[model samples]
Target: MQKHIFNIHDVVLFMTVAECFLLVIFQAILPVKNQLANRLLSTFLISIAITSACILVLWNDDVSLFTAFDEYLLPYFLVIAQMLKGPLLLIYVIALTEDAFKLARRHLVHLIPAAVAVAWLALFQIDSTDLRFRTLGMTETERQIANGVWHFIKIMPFFYALAAVNRVRLYRIGLHNQYSNFSPTEPSWLNILTLGFLFTWSFSILVHVIANTVALAAPQISDLFGIAENYIIFILINALFVNSVVHTHKLLTTKPEAAKDKVDEKLTDTAIQKVQQGMEIQKLFLKQNLNIDEFSKRINLPVKEVSAVINKHYGTNFFEFMNSYRVEEAKRLLSDNQHADMTVMDVLLHAGFNSKSAFHRFFNRLVGMSPTEYRKQNMNKEVKIA
Candidate 1:
């Protein structure tokens, strides 16, 4: 019975790792710009890899090499996984703080301890008997050392949960003031699902730690713990992936009728004058590379009104609207003779674009063709004219 139980748990563990790995691959391959989503997926992948590797090394007897990998590697891996939890939460917060993410170089220093721990493990060449690692069948002290490290790592998830809760609150408050209508910019379902996932993982980790610490009656109980943890992680990952896929599909197929309605409703005679004046003011500042607030002030419209008008009428925000004009000007500059020798990049910057990638993104989005392709087409037209 015990052998069959272990086999079942092993299958679940391997399947969990495979599913999570596919999720990581999906995130890497997909054009997901949500930094929170990216960080969560990445953290899960790294943690799952390290955990699965340690589990196989500790439990698998099919390969002698894995069995001989030493218990020291387990604690080290667990500590690193623990250290990543806090930062992953912070990354989620930073990602959602604003649409334009600015992750500071200094914040990366958070990984210093994890790096040092790994370096210590490698440099000292610590044996399995060291305080960091010991087998479960060893002395009570050794068992404690093994179990304690896992428990310590499990506590880090609470830090992540706290950060997530605070972020959700802030998100709700920000949306309440920012949007004029339903304020559905903050998706309630997503918020609830994210919170539910964070807590589910947190509780599972805590329970696993507690179960191991107490030394339950049957070692098979650990199998139960493993199965539960595996299922929760698997479900959470798949839920997020499915949500992203479905949301994207709907966004592509259903052209945001609510936003369209908002646009149509606001394009009245009085609103059209406001939008026209806003656009004209916007054009004047395009050459100067002005920001949203500056354009809002110049047009004498509230920032929310400005944002709404641009988002609705132009089907883009202030930067995008401004960039469309700049890109058009850049194309004209590229086609003119005085600057004929200048590169496309040179003309892009001279026309107020900040970066090459930004220029390409906006150009492709607005022009429906790559900058190089557009340039080639225009050049051929000039050739025909000559």
Candidate 2:
């Protein structure tokens, strides 16, 4: 029997795998309201862990352990697991960002490649243990096939990562269109995580390409390339694990009620009236990037009391309430012949909207037309009057 050799790479690989496993368990046990999203993330973590474990196993030079394990599980299983990472990540990001996300039958399409790979492996190799063992000893053709599959797996994630980043970007745009102040609604941690994942994936692909090219040109440096790749992967895994823990803790511990409670509860009708008066008299909505906290401070009211009064009297949240004023002001400006020379962008800026999209979104929702359309119609009316 051949003895297994233990090394630093094994330690790092196992440690990273353990971290991913713990994250999966944490997601399972975490008392989040969005169970589906949590489950999707847990599955993603599982894929990552499996992929990491497979890499460790493939790199292992322990003949006895490799022979024992490789018999039952073909290396093609690793390819399948890797194929899962891109789709699972895309699904997880969609689940996180889309409030209305539901797992539809169409989502199954993403798994087709993995399914095909599994079927191919089962039929050609795993169905017979001897064939699987022989495949592990890989002929030139078999090695080429395996490398082609790996190349596909490595390149596949680039597109999915791009999709995830775009999804997050669109989600932010949606938030900004709907809310005047989007800080409270922003998924900062998720955005950071997605960007980090894209960076890590891009770097990994670059390293893989470089390593493959170097290995072909000078076979002697192949071992060094492998070692460097392992180190880079280890560092990336550790960084991801650390980020997940910190962000997960924040997600779990953060309470919406705590934010609401920042407003004082003792605020009376008189104080609410004062807040309204202050808004009208001071035209606080005209201030760019005005938030509830700032408004509360200006009104000398507790944030909770201000929020409660606004909710009760205005029948809307702080953002909508403020945007209603901005929308009304925009309409007034559009209607005034004195401002006819002002461009739509100038009007939007004067109305406290930083972006044309936000201006159009609110204007359309309130006035039943886009800012440009509203301006054109109003200008046409003035021309008819003249």
Candidate 3:
């Protein structure tokens, strides 16, 4: 074994391991809407910490703990972490996004891959001459098999990252559907984590593929690439921690989705008219920081009936329904030179929007132009006098 010397790379990786452990502890103590999801994420972080720690141990031959564990034991055990990560990542996203997601006994089917990995590791360990760790001792055929198996093992995380991105997409769509005027921080961590997974894992897949190819004796090169991966993973874990600690009071929760079935017959057209008339007469949508419940109470109606009218008749959720009115208000403000001195920020605030991003997003989506562009173009419009 070529014993590795400690360097800044080792220091960075040690910090990664330390970060993972501390994050795990923080998650355990933190309160979340879904404890199962928190625990799953913590477990995933633990696997990374263990995997990184094992690599650190392997790099520094000074660590005699490997000698105690029959040299190849810890290395082979790493396969379980590799296999479990894909399943864990997917489940964690599901738990966070799905309000009704219950971790039942049957969900344990995800463990099958890890169990198989353990059995595979046992197969190699039963033979004292482990072909996996001792590549030079293996025949050409054995090396080919080892490399093929390594490629298969590396694909698991890639698959999970894809699944998580899809789940987060649905969750984002639901968020936009339900709420009005979200701050940047709302669901930003989830977005950061999902996109970060895709960004970080692409390097991992490429590194493993290149490392295991027999034509390219690139294990040493692979180790170099892994340092970059560790840095990104370190950033991602820290981002999670920062968001969790800061947003602990306002923990994210999923609202139950409206059923696609027919609207209740009891919610009469008269009730719908009252909701609409009250909204327009009072301009209730212009109320700052207004929510559906407040909107309902202002109109002197049940919240369910108010939500049903917006969802079923207007063909939008409470958020979009409110923004539609706000967009119209913004357009009216922008069209007239009377408010020409008003900035886009001023218009957004007067139109009942708290988030500039949400203001721009809705205005652009509905009007097909930026708020500033719309303002500049229309401010010069002249009224026709016949």
Highest lDDT model number? 3
Candidate 1 lDDT over residue span 9-108, tens digit each: 5676677667767777777877765645575656756676566555654555441244235554555765677567556655654464445565679877
Q: Which candidate is the best by TM-score?
A: 3
lDDT of 3 by residue, 1-386 (tens): 98566778887778888989988988888777667877888998888787677667755555546464536566465667767777887888778766678888998988886776667656544321343346456767666555544565677778778888887777766665545655556466777787788778778888776666532565677777877887888888787677656753353445556565445444588778977886688898788777665677878886667777876777788788888999999999998878988988999999999888889999999999999889777755644421
- Local distance difference test values of all predictions, in order: 0.59, 0.68, 0.73
Query: For candidate 2, what is the TM-score?
Result: 0.58
Q: Model 2, 68-93: lDDT tens per residue?
A: 46655745657677888888888877
Candidate with better lDDT, 1 vs 2: 2
C-alpha RMSD values across all candidates: 14.9, 13.7, 5.0
Residue 135 CA error for candidate 2 (Å)?
A: 6.8
Off by over 4 Å in 2: 1-4, 63-68, 120-140, 184-186, 216-386
Worst 10 residues of 1 by lDDT: 248-257
> How far in Å is the alpha carbon of 345 misplaced in model 3?
7.2
